[model samples]
Target: MRAPRPRAILAVLGVLLLTACGTAGATDGAERATEERVVRVAAAADLKFALEEVADLVAEEHPDVRLDLTYGSSGTFVQQITNGAPFDLYLSADRGYAEQLVDAGLAAPEDLFSYAVGRLVLWTPDGSALDPAPGLTVLAPEDAGTVAIANPEHAPYGRAAVAALRAAGLEEQVRPRLVLGENVAQAAEFVRSGNAQAGVVALSLVLADPLRGHGRWVEVPVDSYPRLDQGGVVLSGAADLGAARAVREVLLGAGGTEVLERYGFSLPGS
Candidate 1:
């Protein structure tokens, strides 16, 4: 065509720009829809290893969903959730904390369910002279200077540790040499780092590889401590309730149970 007017050329360019913008908008929307759907999970430190395996299973099944796990003492998570933390799910080492969340209106009471039963173990780093035993008597040796345990005030594992010690009549003796950790994982870390001679930690932790080989452990008597009936709740403020529920279901299902059992956890109500 004969040379188009400058105005006509400018108009054509504007139309092209508008078309490009529309295409970009549609692409952006599609990308947003496909972006990984993240579900924040606040889990007890004891679930560190097992939960990770469960998360991997979840990822394999639901490629669109991503689990973001935050591990800590269940009591700490309860406080955070009660104070309005943005978590999609809360997996507590103790069922009491989950019930507390339900009672406080932070979670649906019906959504609370027991997932696993945790067991405590006396863990000593590999090559340590200390012998693993059912009771705290192993720590009586002068060389076993200090014992690490989670904080009893806020950690379920810590409370269990204290209970076990009390039942074994060693609470009085061990109390003076106790080095407290913020959570069970940290308590294990204390022993691993040689800051303590031994630690009372979750059996799940000691069963996982790397850690399993890193230390020697003995199961504490079940009667020595109260049952660790672990439970989980979907938070009332969940960003994706469906996804949260799906993850919970996966954990309660066969595949998840297999992973939990592999990590030394017992299924609840089993």
Candidate 2:
């Protein structure tokens, strides 16, 4: 084989350079794809079930984005967010909390939007003699034992339970017997674990797979308490603002609404 001519040698070198550049580009692209894109969300306890489904929707829609969800009372989360907890999104069981964040400048008003209206329920695990179908009246009996509710101090569902009890004229009688949980999910757990005879919990919890069909529950009359009016907001310090906004969209989108509805959440305006 002979040495290549000058023009031919230059052409070969150009092709080699192009190939190397293409390989480098492909490697960079692959590296970019492998880097995990995450969005951290602080959500209300009542969303324990429905939000997980919404997360599935997020996964299907944005394969590169991963959601890290933490569930608790909206009030507790409000305090956490206020104290500078690093979260990309905040989903509150009460829209008022989201509004509170907007007012405080922790989240933008434009980034805040209502998602769903939650419902409260009277729940009793399987084999309980208590008939919750009669509504809040079941708690009237002296033998009603300990009734669990989320702590009204910070939990919206707990506040709603208080309101419902008052509306049913049972506040005075049931107040002394109430067992308060840190959040609504814990309230349900109190009943499920047999620590409490009955509970006033988020309807979505009873409808979730883990508890569904394993117990019985009756809707606490919507009129009996203030509407839940759940909401979500993209935080101002979101690590990935774009991903946070995408999450907000997924929760309010048709697919997310469908999941919320299936889990017994009422949509806003519809």
Candidate 3:
């Protein structure tokens, strides 16, 4: 072959250089695009705000893991989980529900993690004539308009609300005007929307952003109802058990504890 012309050689070299640079850039981009694994979670409605904050903390530490949460009543969740729902984690409002899963063979006992002890609150809209200062007895009047509470059949908070009402000797009066929500959050919404004059809901819900400044709340006496020690479990069928375990540790870690405490949940030791 004849000796290549100088300009042609330089052009060939330039094309090769450009091709190499493009390849390097592509490789770098691929390396930076880390894949995140999704963990499906079924959490109690009482954990709506706190769990969201905990999930944010989980994201910060484990960029490779992501949580997709579904919130509802713990009892209902227990039934769903028993029926083989595809949730990676089940965070219940009552730890007993988690234990039930363990007993039912749906979850291993070692996988259960206690998250927090939940509190119930009596909430009233800001300008409403009703005041929760009088405690559960505030709903005793026949003309108290309407009272909202979670259904005791499924929601832990609902059972607590009913207990508190009964303890206060107001069950008869309150039950007559009670509006049962599917979950504690929904009961708070009933109060927020003015559908009910008063609500018996999770302290966390009333303390969360949406209801924080718009309503007034009084904590229900802890002795009136069973202690709502909340807990969760990594499902036996979790797609990413490692990720599920990592998320569990995040909840037990300081950041998650702070978020839970800030939302009115009591720590196990505290």
Model 2: C-alpha RMSD to truth?
A: 4.0
lDDT of 3 by residue, 73-148 (tens): 9999999988988899999988889999999988888998888999988899978998788787767778878999
For candidate 2, list the clashing residue pairs, or say none: none
Model 1: residue 131 alpha-carbon error in angstroms? 1.1
Q: Write the per-residue lDDT of candidate 2 for residues 111-132, one digit (tens) a residue.
A: 9999999999999988788989
If ranked by TM-score, best first, what sequence of candidates would result?
1, 2, 3
Best by TM-score: 1
Per-residue lDDT of 248 in model 1 = 91
lDDT tens digits by residue: candidate 1, 1-270: 899999999999999999999999999999998998889999999898888889998998888989999999899888888888889999999999999988988888789999899999998887788888645788765667889999999999999999999988788888999999999999998998899889999898888775878878889988889999999999889998999998998899899999999998888876
Q: Give the TM-score of candidate 3.
A: 0.88
Clashing pairs in 1: none
Model 2: lDDT to the true structure: 0.92
Structural similarity to truth (TM-score) of each candidate: 0.95, 0.89, 0.88
Per-residue lDDT, model 2, residue 95, is 89
